[model samples]
Target: MNAEQHESGSWYWEVGSEQCPHGPEPDYDTQPEAWDIWIDRHTGSPQDVRICLDAPAGEACLQCSEDDGEMVPWESCRIREHARPKQGVVPNPGAEHQPVTVLVGTLECLDRECDEYFGDDGDEIPDMESCSHIREEQACSCQRQDDGEYSNDPCPARSLSVTGGTA
Candidate 1:
């Protein structure tokens, strides 16, 4: 069976190999140009179709690139007018479903009030207030104890824990 696009952009397919006086005309808003439309030979109804928008200007065959890595023009390709899947046949569901894992956690950082200082390499810079270069370090306003602990106030560093999911 063959199909044609009307001037009004509607699609119609031939009833059989030979043209019938009365044919089925399916009205589609847009034309299926350049793509091969698979139709049922007996009913002249569309089953499945092949479309390749990325195909350069004249290429139409979907397997052109897969066959020889060369695009076959629509005009040059042989049109398989009678291509349709068997009626009422279901396709196989490939692959088993895998369980999805979910995780929940909190993200926290040290507050600005915390006087923790780190060097350019991310190593903790000790004794910032007593350092000779303390004047050069803008963030060095150390109020920490000599034992490297927060003096009077609690440590502002937050502890994050995973409270949910398969940890």
Candidate 2:
């Protein structure tokens, strides 16, 4: 850290690790030495300067001297991609004695209100093709109540078949 008095106000700037044009700047060995030099030129304590550093850069820049102002740490903080739920209408029920057929498809964030699927790109979609719950037929096998004795094979009950979807 280094400071120089200007006409408007004094300013502080840090030069660290990197080689300076004039060999090394004053007190370049350690952060404490740099702090000492910075304090000597400024009127605040080291703790005060540290508080400023810990604060968010947006507010820090607003309050701190323009020459020493730093930008917010944007690179350190960012939102990563999130898995969004795909959307599609469930198929309607089929005719009598037949189970309803449904084809589960994936839909990107198309509606503005749905938070789960809201996305900027229309193509970004959740994996609906691999969902095991989606089957080709609604119901395949049937189960019957077992008799007390063994070999309680009974008539199969009416069941729906899975038509299509991710499966």
Candidate 3:
């Protein structure tokens, strides 16, 4: 039998050929036979076989399709989508009035208890004037200290200003 050695060092023999000179061996399996045929027909290496087998059906085989000139079976091998520049908003010419800006400034708090008292259920206080903890005319003393409680000192009221365009 004609003896052939695989990468694993296992020897196989062609049935009805000259017996292996060294010792008895099993008949060549279909996988080895196909591998030899593929190598011979495509003039490809063992590594090429691995690449073709590992690659998905419609994707490019790295070993055979690495060259730019080589043809890939898929329509496109690109994995990421192309990014385009964002478009800016265009102002409407038919609009009757221009945009206005409203500025609301709140009193800055130094004390942690005052800060929590200003917040509604852990969220920022929507309107500082609406909170019962705030003192309308008096300046902040910054002396409030207690857990889950508000002090008698009320934070100063915030000023509101509206600008831009005729109001």
Candidate 4:
């Protein structure tokens, strides 16, 4: 995925500003570096490539204006109506503006059927690498040993099973 459509893209460029708000003076670095610094502020770690932002209710609905200044609040700026979701062909404006009720940090595993990956205390199973027995025999796409040999534990299917058990 590219930067343009991501939340990070909003702060990816200094535009009319002379320097990044958090990094070395704008004079010390190139435009791209300034952008990288700006994006880093909203992220938890320096290595985090993407920052998931909640486009404030009505703020992210408007497209950035050409005359808009560099220091304006980008996260709250409305997304351009013409901008489309990169993963898919068409942009669904209706879906885009809907507030995301799910926050990342508080999410819990709810899959009832995934007893092997959960503990008696109703928490995610510890030692995910050794959960599945079958996983020991099958290598992952990286062609390495399956870490979760006892349970085949944390594949995409099993990961989501943490919440309310699989249907």
The local lDDT score (0 to 100) that residue 83 gets in candidate 1 is 17
Q: Write the per-residue lDDT of candidate 1 for residues 77-103, one digit (tens) a residue.
A: 232221111223222334122111211
Cα lDDT tens digits for candidate 3, 1-167: 11121011111222222432322223357467655644432223233322222222344423223433343332122221111111232224454232212111122221213464455568766555332332323222231222212233433331223346775
Model 3 RMSD in Å is 28.2
Q: Give the C-alpha miss distance for residue 157 in model 4, angstroms.
A: 11
- Compared with the true structure, the alpha-carbon lDDT of candidate 1 equals 0.27
Model 3 residue pairs with clashes: 1-17, 1-18, 1-19, 135-154
Q: For candidate 2, write residues 1-167 as lDDT tens digits.
A: 11122122222333221221122334545667765655453343322442222222232222224334443221111121112223342223342232222322221112222334334675433642434322232321121112111111231344233356784
Quote the positional error of residue 53 for candidate 2 in Å. 66
TM-score of each: 0.14, 0.14, 0.14, 0.17
Q: How much RMSD separates candidate 2 from the native structure?
A: 23.3
- How accurate locally is residue 75 in candidate 1, as Cα lDDT from 0 to 100? 28
In model 4, the worst 10-residue window by lDDT is 99-108
TM-score of 1: 0.14
Looking at model 3, residue 64 earns an lDDT score of 26
Task: Give each model's whole-structure lDDT.
Answer: 0.27, 0.29, 0.29, 0.31
**Of the candidates shown, which would achieve the greatest lDDT relative to the real structure?**
4
**lDDT computed for candidate 4:** 0.31
Compare the candidates by TM-score and give the number of the best one. Answer: 4
Superior by lDDT: candidate 3 or candidate 4: 4
